[model samples]
Target: MRKSEYRISELLDRLARLNQSELWTNDLNPAQVAALKYLMAANRFSRAPSHVADYLGATRGTVSQSLKTLAKKGLIEQIRSAEDKRSVRYDVTKTGHSVVAIRTNLDEALAQLDQNESANIALLLSNVLHSTLAARGGRSFGICKSCKHHDKSANRPYCRLLIVELAEEETSLICHEHDSAA
Candidate 1:
C-alpha cells in the first residue's frame, strides 16, 4: 500500500492519541462531539437535527443523546423552522460559540503560516487528515460564511457560498469570518 494510504484500522489508532479524556470528565461525550461537529459545520446558525446526524456519521439516537447534554448545558437551543413545521434547528449558545471560537486563533495562525510553509509538509498533513475524513465521507466545510466578506441585508443576507441573493434570517450558519454589523 502507498504511504499515503494507511490501512483504515491503523488510521484511528494514530488519531486516538489526539483524543482527550478531559472533555468527558467534565460531562462531555462522543455524542456531544457529533452535535458540536455539526454545529461547527453549520456555522452559528441552526440546522435540522437530521442533517447534523448525517454529517457526523452518527445515528439519530446518537445525535439526540448528545443534543440533550448540550441543551442541558445551555450550549445549544432548538428553534422552530418557518419552512418546515415538524423540523427544528439547533443554534449554539454564546457559550457554545466560545467553545468553538477558540479555534479562531489557530485559523489565523494557519492563514499566516500558509505564506511560507513548504508545499511538501502541507500536502502531507492534508493527505493524512483528508484520508481519515474521506474514509467517513466527512469534509472540513471551510468557506467564507466565516469570513469578513459576508454581509446581512435586512433579515436575509447574500453570501459567497452561492450567487443567489440571501438574508441573515436565511443563513443556517455563520463562521468566524463574518464581521459583526457596523
Candidate 2:
C-alpha cells in the first residue's frame, strides 16, 4: 500500500465537520471565522491593517472590509494607535475574546480527544507547526520562531522535529509529510 498525502483543503474539511462543538458560539460565517483565526494566531490581534495584511496574505482593502464587518458586529473594536492615530488597531471585544478563547481551547481539546489510536501523529503535526513557526524567526510573543519547540541543528536548522529527512545542502528543510522526530 502506498502512503497518501493529505491536502490542506481536505484537512480543513475534516476539521470543519468535526467542529460541531460550539467553541465559538457566535454566529460567524466562514470569513468571520478566518478573521478571528488570524487575529488569535497573530500578535494578540493588536496590530493595524498592515499587520493583518501580512498575516492573512491579504490586501489592506480586504482586511479593512473584514475589520469593518467585525466592528459592526461588535465582535471586535478598533482603537486608534496612540503613537499614530491615523493607524487603527483591532482587538477582540469582551465577547470576541470569550469566543476566541473558547475556540482555541476547544481546538486543543478536540485534538486531545483522539488520545488512543493516531494521537501520536496528531501530536507530531502540532510539533511540526510549532517548529515551522520558529524557523521563520517568529517569537512566542509574536510569531512562531519565538516558540520553545523550535530546534536548530546542523542537520535541521530552526527545526527540532525530525518530520522528514534533510537534504545535503538544505538539510534544514524537512519532509512535512514525514512525522518522525530526528
Candidate 3:
C-alpha cells in the first residue's frame, strides 16, 4: 500500500482505540456500556439482541449475557414485540441513556476541531469506512433515508429491500440493511 493509505489506516485505528480507551466508573462493563450506547442511538428496527451482536461483531452468547446484565441493572428493558409475540426488543432506560452521556476525553479533543475541519474529517472517514466495508463484504449501517433502497415516493417511506414501512423517526436512524445512495 501507499504511504498515504498506511497513514490513514494507522490514524483511523489509533483514533478508534483512543476513543474507547477510557472506561466509565460505573458498574457496567465496557461491553455493556457499548451495548447501551448502541441501543440508545439505534432505530427501532435495530433494537434486537441479534442486531446488537451484528453491530458489535460479538457472538450471540456474549450479547445475550450483556443484555441480561443490562436488564438486571435497570439500564435496559426487554419488551415483547408488538408485531410478533415471540419476538423481543430492547429499550434503553433513562439511566442507560445517562450512562452513555458520560463524555470522554476523546469528545473534548474532537470538540477542539473547527466545524469545517470536523465536517471534512467526517466525510473522509465515512468514505474510508464505506470503502473498507465494501471490500470486506461487511454490512453498511447508514441511515435508511440516505440508502439507495429507501423509497420516499409512497405515502410512507419504506425500504424496497426489506419491504417494510418506515416510521418518520426511523428515517434518520442507522439500518442493518442500509446501502449507500451513492
Query: Count of backbone clashes for each model?
Result: 11, 12, 0
* TM of each candidate vs. truth: 0.57, 0.51, 0.84
lDDT for each candidate structure = 0.60, 0.56, 0.85
Which residue runs does candidate 2 get wrong by more than 4 Å?
Answer: 1-3, 6-9, 16-25, 44-46, 101-111, 114-182
Worst 10 residues of 2 by lDDT: 172-181
Per-residue C-alpha lDDT of model 3 across residues 1-182, encoded as one tens digit per residue:
99998997898788777767675448877788888888887877788898898888788899999999999999999999887998888999988888888988878988999999999988988888777777877777888798999999989998889888989888988777777756
Most accurate candidate by TM-score: 3
RMSD of each: 7.6, 11.2, 2.4
Give the local distance difference test score of model 3: 0.85
TM-score between candidate 2 and the true structure = 0.51
Candidate 3 clashing pairs, residues 3+ apart or interchain: none
- By TM-score, rank the candidates, best first: 3, 1, 2
How accurate locally is residue 138 in candidate 2, as Cα lDDT from 0 to 100?
37
